[model samples]
Target: MAQLDISSSAISIPTLLIVNRYFDEVTSNIRERPMPWEGYQRASLITEQELLLLRNYSSRTGLKDQPTAEKYIDLFLILINKLSRMDALQYILVAFDDTIQKFPDTLVYLCQLEVKSEGSPFNTLKRCLGKDDDYLNLKAAKIITDLLNHASPKFVQTFDFTDLLLWLNRQLQSENPNVVDVSVQILQGLLKLRSFRPVFYGKAHLMNIFMGLIQASREGNPQMLYQLLFCLWLLSFEPIISDSLDKQYGVISQLVAIAKGASKEKLTRIVMATLKNLLVTAPGDNLAAMVAVKLLNFCDNLATRKWTDEDILDDIEFIRQELTERFQKLSTWDEYVSEVESGHLSWTPSHQSDAFWKMHASQLAADRGRLLNCLAHALNVPNQDPTVLAVAAHDIGQFVKYYPLGKKMVQDSGAKQKIMELLTHPNADVKYRALVALQVLMSHAWDQ
Candidate 1:
């Protein structure tokens, strides 16, 4: 007879309460603390009948009765009592591997079982990262990532993200780019953990996680770059993170390089989205200004992006609008170098809008940068769009003629060369507009 650890009172067979009573009796004296590897040992902990049941279940190529298997939940309870460190880890790892293979149809159900436990397969996998089976470690890491991506937060949070990040960070130093890439991907999964936060993953002794992420963006791996950019997009939501990226590493510049160099549509789109997230957080920020300038690199070929993916096009448009709005609000009077160069109008308004105290002269004259940027954009891409060039040149003419210290500062912007380039333009109206704008800006020289 299989003896209970404690005595059980007999009750009717088919009821759940009676079953619990019997289970309580069986396990009451069972050891609460298990040795790790005890569960993995060939010497099974459950009754002979239970062992025979599992043996019968294992013999079949398929699961005939999954619910009946569930009824044998005491397998875990018994192991939790008897398993030691090594065997417990080995048990879960084998179970994870077998569950994936044996129950392809029950994957979600089976993975959920491991995911919600602190001692689950991935926790064991994390420990194995420094072990000799790196290939298996990566394979297991990938499986864990896929599981965590789909797992519920309640289950995902059960894993310790800090430890996972530290392990993955160490793996980033692998000689194989594929290894580094997989490690980066696993770190991406760590970001999705419910309790995950953006604490710096440590550079005091080793390469910090964010540094690795930034470096990956600049390196040649598109897959790694995509995952890194995705994390940055999420991290950018936090002020501490966004500010650290800007103030400490100037990561925004690296992101621009990545976006500019990326040939893949998906890679470019994520890089673009990541930049947008960073810029949107503090539009008036210094890095925002640099990023705004960096973003202009695309202006010369904006049409190529117009036919790109709809999602990327939307991101481009968002960046465009935000930059335009932010720059408009940024005072440009301070940037005007005319009077300082010409030694006239010794003092200018502190505000660009105040430059138009002579209201109705032209809004363009009030902000010199806006007019210069407008003309530059037109002259670059609107080479054939004459009306764009015309309006832009007309704005420059007004800015040069009416704004304080206009001619000197406008000339200092290299406006003369742009105007000369347009003078021979094929479109008569565009040529005329450039000619007029230049005449106004250079009128002082003619007068002198």
Candidate 2:
């Protein structure tokens, strides 16, 4: 610990005047040098002892009012740049804590200078971040983040870093679009640096904070949302960090919902790409089924348009092909039952599982009367598709086959009349389902 030597009253008055005159000469000489960036490379060649002297002088009582503060700050930044260039960052690391504490405002201004540098600030930061000292790097990261949070739009816009994730987080909370945009850009840059990966992962709540940004995009900030989603997508490519199921499911669910409702074709395509990325990375039976169900709903909506029958049929064929492929991947009913019985089914389909389609199939086969009531409600909606109606009817017929009680419920509830009317539907699938349901009812009556 170097002590301040301000109490040396025994020193001659002439010596003090000479020191003051030297200070004036030094300040005057500093004016001859070019701007900070121009002189940074050369001035940073100064020796450690000289650098310490400058540091000490910059901290003297009258130094703040003297022109020396700005010059010293500039010279220190040159040293930073040199450290970055010569890879002598450990030396800077030893002094960074005290340097920042004594001149917090200087660190902020140096960050601005780095941002304005012509060469890559990202690469420079990367060199500094690669030092073996974690505490120093973390301190530097904190300072950079603080500076970026309060930096003007111009400074923030040109900023880049490989260890500024903390600052990126602060920028994420900014209300300014330009700041947010630049911050995201900076994050993207940092993410590309392999050295920063551990730092990024160590920052807890990072994934959740990003997801919150994704959710915010739904209300009209798709640009920021898209940037965040893309970053998450890129991150998911890394096996070690991307293995968390909660992070995967949360991001995917939001993306899938957005894809389903997005009117813009490009955004829809991007969302679809994100979904595909997720599936490729962490495919599960339930997730596959949920995707299939969403695709089916999309197809059903598309079918209602008054297009040529041939075009509609072609679209339906494509959708059916996709659904069939996905459905084949779903666990069979017997498999599900076995899993449930064996306690292997940790997730319930009704709540977290996307097996609602299969559940619908099962309920219809075991309880026609309940199926009929559900159909009644579905049919009441205007512009309801006949295919959905037919599927419901087929499910009901299956229920009647497995459960005699379903027929009793239908007959007792007068749902049989509705089933008979559906038999006259123009769509063959609906008529077939309706006829099959009615025949099952008649058979039950005859058996009795």
Model 2 compared with the native: what TM-score? 0.39
Model 2 clashes, total count: 4
lDDT of 1 by residue, 195-229 (tens): 45344322433335556556855666566667777
How well does candidate 1 score on lDDT at residue 94? 39
Q: lDDT of all predictions, in order shown?
A: 0.52, 0.49
Error of 1 at 63 (Å): 3.2
lDDT of 2 at 355: 48
lDDT of 1 at 386: 73
- Per-residue lDDT of 399 in model 1: 67
Among the numbered candidates, top lDDT falls to: 1
